[model samples]
Target: MRRRRGLTEEERELWSRVAASAQAMHPARPEMPAALTPPPREPVVAPKSLAKAFRVGEKARPRTGHDLAPPIGEGLAALPVVMDRKAHRNMVRGKLEPEAKLDLHGMTLAQAHPELIHFVLTAQDRGHRLILVITGKGKPGRDDDPVPQRMGVLRHQVPHWLRLPPLGAVVMQVTEAHLKHGGAGAYYIYLRRLR
Candidate 1:
């Protein structure tokens, strides 16, 4: 390496002047403007104001399938598990017939649990594509009852059970059964083929 040369007297003077000028221009900590100072309370944007600010353009794209919309009626018994459009269409049209079915209408959760597991496993072993499982819409409760009856326990619980481990692994889709197959009281469980 070559021997390094030190800065000239003029260069040293120039650097010192620049440093001094910079120090004079800025303080150690800047004094923020009152407008920029954080407020004690959390800031909130009004919904209407925010909506207007983000209002869609005149040429906005049409709503797609993913867009949120109100259900036609009271909505599905249980949200259908994920499936392609063609499979869903076929099932909805009642083209795919169930190979086996299990009705847990009058049975409690305990009674239904073992039956459901056994039925699904048996159907899967036999290579059944579609099967119906009826979980009756619970009885209507009196309007004047102090606490409303938790009707349709099976309707709600069955979907959750099908989504749990082992069951979820075998099940492809779980949709509300067609009117011919017990309507909202039942579900169509589409099972995956054995590997």
Candidate 2:
């Protein structure tokens, strides 16, 4: 390595003058007012947010503030586990085959809600312990609307409906399906046994 030398007084003076006379390549821009400026984003995920341990049929803790609604998998995990532990594990792993299934993909909210109630109620009446409800991961694509539309209405709403009046009384548990059973595109609805 070569020894470095400090700039002599004359050399420093020359550099200072040259720099002072030179123009900036880009003009300075005025700082944006705080009201108009976008706020700094929080970390998409933090190390601390991850679960310390992961197990089959484990509930998920929320991870980010940007989510309009938690993903179906996470939302289902947060719900209290009402089914048997062994059955729950087997079901989430796609081992326990659903006795029946309902597909709500391509239907609007108005059309889907009533159908879901009817399908779930009829399934319960038939003594089905578990049923699959396919909402199809919502349409994935570019959303250019200025009004801000949130897609996957059924994916988010179905879980709420399963836990609400009418159907809530019969629905025992709800969980995201495994890869063999349609992965994130479907749900496994566990219905309560008839008295």
Error of model 1, residue 179, in angstroms: 0.6
Off by over 4 Å in 2: 1-66
For candidate 1, the TM-score is 0.56
lDDT of each: 0.79, 0.85
lDDT of 2 at 20: 98
lDDT per residue (tens digit) for residues 11-79 in model 2: 999999999999999999999898999988887774575656778657876432234655668867887
Q: How far off is residue 139 in model 2, in Å?
A: 1.3
**Native-referenced Cα lDDT, model 2:** 0.85
Residue 117 displacement (Å), model 1:
0.8
Residue 123 accuracy (lDDT) in model 2: 93
Highest TM-score among the candidates is held by which one?
2
